[model samples]
Target chain A: MTATSPTARTGQVASAQPSARPGKRGDRTGAASRAPWLLLAPFLALFILTFVLPIFVAVGSSFTKVTRSGLFGEAGVKSEFAGFSNYAQALADGSFVASIGRMLLFGVVQVPVMIVLCTVLALMLESASAKWPGFFRAAYFLPYGVPGVIATILWSFLYVPGLSPLFDVAALVGLTPDFLGANTVLWSIANIVTWSYTGYNMLIIVAQLKAIPGELYEAAKVDGASTWRVALSIQLPLIRPALVLTTVFSIIGTLQLFAEAQVLKTVAPTIDSQYTPNLSAYTTAFAYNDYNVAAAQAVLIAVAAFVLSFAFLKFTNRKSS
Target chain B: MTATVTPTSTSASPARTSAAGTRRSGSKGRPSTIIVTAVLVVVALYFLIPVYWVVVAATKSTEDLFSTNGFWFAPTVALWDNLAQVLSYDNGIFIRWFLNSVLYAGIGALLATYFAAAGGYALAKYEFRGRNLVFGTILGGVLVPGTATALPLFLLFSQLGLANTYWSVLLPSLVSPFGLFLCRIYSQATVDTSLIEAARLDGAGELRIFHTIGLRVLTPALVTVFLFQLVGIWNNYFLPLVMLSDSGLYPITLGLNNWLSQVDRLPEFYELTTGGVLLSIIPLSIAMVVLQRFWRGGLTEGSVK
Candidate 1:
């Protein structure tokens, strides 16, 4: 991997020398001019087809409403331009707003806790005195390899009353807290998300930690700085980019919480079909066959995610720079 | 700043290396080290418990699953029985789902990686009009949560008569904005512009150059992108759930979820879901262990760039 870097530098120099000459005079440059477009064509085609077109369709559908024309609605439904009605309806939805608020609360509480845990774990692993870093790293990271659905399923087994060994243990202590209970189910889902992602975030932070030169540690040690002090002063400050990255990702993921909640809805009576924003949109579209409203909800969720993530990036960049 | 730090650090590094070594060996008796290790060990157990429970649960009979201790093995080992039952249940649908997941992830990642590599290489090595515009658009795609697209994609696909088909799931899975972004950065880091120029001078076509030299240099990054996309599509639930209503076409994630949702009514599906989950995870866990370097390298490279 390191070998590629120097070659890349030299390649920059080599390419720069030629591009300096007049572009119109060189036959080689003329042929290579169109190569970029040719190479980019396949990805561009797929990107527009999958990414751009869907958003266009979504936005278009979000502005329209389906109306029944014939008796018994058997003559087929016609789509008419509804202007902002779908968006209005979606915005007016109490459950939808509540779900979004729930997700926001989830992010506010969970993201910080997870980030701190990940940072602490990464620091522990990166410390010079730490032993068996490899074993612990893999052990922590193992959950990331497990699919979120499977991880949720595994945790749900622990959350359910009779099926849970944790419950049995709680029974032994005479304190069986209802994990999947309506009041506590959100935290249970939060636990699942944290378990699934904490290690992945830790790995990112640890990577950032590794890039910190060994000299920093030595310099700190020579200056009589302790391990904890070095970690606080050096490691934490340097890993700001990674911390920002993971926090933004967690925020976006928080709003898109569907699979765990959707799966848990069956086992937990407290979780409604519209327990999450994504789940609400999913059920509205598929279960109720209300595509326009679902499209509006999805667009709203996307906008919220975009704004939150962009704000985070802007905030972090301003501070870092 | 880094230049000044490097030389001073290097000159003092030899003594520091030995000092660090001694410190590491000598720190075993420290209370702080022991406490940190113990804390890590406890966290590791927290992560490992579910996996351990699943393995143990898969071995028990239905009677044992409910009656036996949730953490330990039952009187009789029924792992094979459970595996057989899971594989044979519902006309071998679990096996079908397993194969479907392999197909979706394997082929989807392959094509996605190729496109990302090609696109990234182009963006990095070639200067053109609208380059930054294209790059910016793709960067924007990275922020758009995928679940946000599922409902829209379903509407579009249904209109095109592609809904309830494999293409609906596979087509959308192929466009990974993150993979493309990673590849662009990786290509900039690894693929030499001069090498492409040289290959062009040898009368090789642009496509030929990319295939022969560019692909070779970008192999490690491509593998990283491939693995990321592979795991992503393998673990994906919402897209398939929204796109394909046909249970026959469900991936392992969706199919296992279906089985799990039925566990309350059927009650026999508990072992099957456990067995199916274990089966689904085996390949991913093996890949993670074996491809540890690429995974770490990809993530670090992505963040640093």
Candidate 2:
């Protein structure tokens, strides 16, 4: 678990409503005491059944081996303990290893660009002089409502040479962008992601910017700080929490990149079955019929996400404190 | 759109909109102002083009889809024709998918919202013995990615003969750790203890107190949790893709992808696929606009404490 797993990060703030209970009030009323347990039982039971048990099942199954009598594992099969072999095999697969590396590179470049872009857009739109902030925010945010599969389908049309007016416009200027080429396809997918998400991340930062007391800006203005100076000295430092939250979320999202790549597999030759860690695990389980090995790969994907997000929260928390 | 602006300071249209222009300091025509406006306008167009293209392409026949420009309307608008085809294709599977999405997102999110509210209000109000342990364990669920859980859940569900069933997807969609987390924070911050105490003192039963007082106070937070989980479940692809083999149970995402994967051999699916994508997003877009405030409030509560 993260040190400040988003929820626990914010315990104390200026509550708009006043409450008299500072310490835990010693109340052992008859019906009230049992109500909490009753209320919490269904959610807690479902949470464990879905979230907790699967994790244990995945880890437990990851260490097992399955042997089948028939080709394609269509006949009687038995599962036995596999030990660390699945982990070893997953790591040794060049494509699986490469997919993890690809995600790391993707996260490194994409997360910062998104955070900075979102922050800048939030600062600008929330600024006093900007016109139609609501309209622009909606315009930017409209894409997040479009599902990833839909977004990719829409973009692929633009990328295909004959279909898009964008291509026609680019051709007149003596430039032809091969968006589906092996080398450029990854970045083209990145463009789709960037377009879809920038507005959402910007909205989070805008919420944080709105939470800042109006008196802080008034005080800064009284001191004759230029807009640029105020943004740097005050706004940036104060919004670090939002930045950290967004960064962690982005890392998790990038590591789980599957739907876009899966949808693009037929059109883009560069993308294969094992183009991402999630996709690798998926293909291993369903197509190759290796649930035990697929479990290991899935476990590794989760571990990588945890490691990355934990490291980020650690780094940010240290600097902030 | 209009190039003529008198800068009288009264009328604030979007043409006055720029990245960094200060209508505040009476500096309307600053070079930075033009740069801001131009830059933002261009970014807006970037986001708008794909959406506009989908709308245009949805109006074309399958033949026109290939022959005409992707961004422009065809000579004749076949939008109604395409709509009819998309809805009626394969015995109206698209309608089934749309309804499936609504059912999954609607009922799943409502249950999730209620669960989060009830559980969160408990953790916020009660001083139980295992409160921290239960709450802390639930928070750990937040770190587990959805894909990780899907594989094992699919495996388990298959073992129990539940795979390819609606329960396989709906059961998982019912749990939202992030929503639960947000609910706790919002409840803690918003739900005052004295109000609950007074309600209890008014001879109200515990469940009644929760229904009348606790839930009433946590209404905004509940809405926030609902919207997030609604979108989360609606936008979900991996679960349904992994859980259900039956196209009858397919949500829009999986169904659309299924259509996309087949477009090369059966070229006529192009119109159906594009038209389906256009129709799927219509409700989501409306929900985004209507529930925009609640979402912002949700983010502010969790992100800015």
Candidate 3:
């Protein structure tokens, strides 16, 4: 199905080629060619200022080390090229590495659960027999409208024993689980992430499901396929792109888990300042004042994100092919 | 086959038409359907519970908040008093943060949407040199997680003496790579090249044609991009946390977090924080409910394409 779509698009482009020839010729002229660039100028300018320059700055700073001077190392500091020493130090830091590992474990566990839940919710909402699908869809997605910090605060209330109704119910049952404990905090963070994003991801999958040609379902129905059968064979297979997209997004989001952990740190004493890689980078820069090491860690995090996402895309593409 | 499989005609709900083909047909009143619906309802309740808790918790005074049931309202309501206290605390700083958030998200999204539309329109409708390169670079930007750049941005802004200022947050928020990508896909699907060619043949300048013709056709997409960016900027915490030091320039997220961190010292801030959080979410929730179609369209356009 994926293979045919590109060829079909190419066929359309081929048929449309004759008409586009004159336009292409006209576009070669100086003024005509300049128009596209002119329209793109504002976006590119901001993109460079915000995206490109910062990346270059971060990359450059990552290779340099900061040196302190004076009695308390407060009077003067110098920065000089250190030739990957900062990277070495960042990779050597056990706590930073542990944070990254924790994030990886978090993503591994949380992402699949979130994706499955999103898929199920999306499928249920799109099912014909579901009542008030619109209401459920909106209710499921409303959390995406709330900011992560606010969501964390709300969940923190539920985690705290004195404040949470969940605790009251748990206590009555003789089971008091400490959600914000050092061991359980990771899962608690995962819960918040899933709650915040499940709807957003579900929306994406539902969009893909909506895009499926009705004739395909019609044909499947004529074959006496059940709703569950059609969903597994047609909807799930066809929505692969959306699933992969959501997974890649979830992976990136997981690695950059900062806001929920940061906000919960106020209430959950077990949540250290360096709970996630992003948080560690943040603390390293602001608290330790080691901008170079922080930059190195940031660069490493970006590289890891790129590598993981690219690998996932490649693996999925290879499998599909 | 079409008559039998099309689900909209079978569903009793009026809203089902919008979601027509996505739904399964002939499944109403089935046992599996009932189970599915029940599970979905439970999931919906799980999602809404936290927001509901906050709403109920916000109405209680600090004394009543701890004493009363956690999920229900207090016997005597104090929502108005909590709002007053939240607004008046630290000389009405919550109101300032609210305005700052409005400024950041409102103007930032507007400008970002415009830039995305213009850029996306060019990429979609016009053929130019290095177009692929430009698009590729933007795609690369989309994958570079925004948090990874926050510290670097802070450093760069500090170098330029822009740190702790409104521009620090506003400048970064103005560039939305994901929005640009969405706009590109949307413009491709919606905008017509023949119209542009005709406009050019009639001696309409490129800028005028885009402003008058292209933007008019792209209003739906523009709204989609705008809302996406608005929510993103509104929900943003880390960018401002790293960039700004002044409370006056803080967005609602940072402001509320600051208030929350101080709750350990003065528990009175709990009611204020809850009130502040509830207030902060109202605008975005309204936007979500009203502009639901556009963002949904934006999401589908983004992921499907």
Per-residue error for A159 in candidate 2, Å, reads 1.5
- Chain A of candidate 3 gets a TM-score of 0.89
Tens-place lDDT per residue, model 1, B151-231, is 888888889999999999999888878887887887888788888778776899878898999889888788889988998
lDDT of 2 by residue, B1-305 (tens): 11111221212333343233242455465655555556566667777778889899999998888787776788999999999999998899998999999999999999999998889888888987899999999987888899999999999899999999889989998888888888788778888889888877777778888888888888877888888888888888898999999999999999988988888899878888889989998888877877777789877776544
Cα TM-score of candidate 1: 0.91
Name the docking class for model 1: acceptable
Across A65-116, the per-residue lDDT of candidate 2 in tens digits comes to: 8888888668887888889999999999999999999988888877787777
Model 1 Cα displacement at B49 (Å)?
Answer: 0.3
Candidate DockQ scores, in order = 0.36, 0.41, 0.40
- For each candidate, give its TM-score against the true structure: 0.91, 0.90, 0.91
Error of 3 at A268 (Å): 1.5
Please give, for residues A1-321, the per-residue lDDT of candidate 3 as tens digits.
343344444655546655455444444354566778898999999899899999999999999977889877798878889998999999999989999999989988889888877887777688776788888888878899999998998898889888888888777889889998989999988889988998888888888988888899888767866666777799999999889989999999888889999999988889888899999999999999889999999999999999999999999999998
Q: List the residue pairs that clash in candidate 1.
A: none
lDDT of 3 by residue, B1-305 (tens): 11111222222232322233334556566555666576666677788888899999999999988888887888899999999999998999999999999999999999999999899988988877689999999999999999999899999989999999999999998888888887788788878889988988887888899899989988877887898898899999999999988888999999999988998999999999999989988888877766777767766666544
On a 0 to 100 scale, what is the lDDT of residue B22 in model 2?
45
Residue pairs with backbone atoms closer than 3 Å in model 2 (clashes): B18-B37, B19-B36
Q: Identify the runs in model 2 with alpha carbons over 4 angstroms from their true place.
A: A1-30, A70-76, B1-31, B302-305
* Fnat of model 3, as a fraction: 0.67
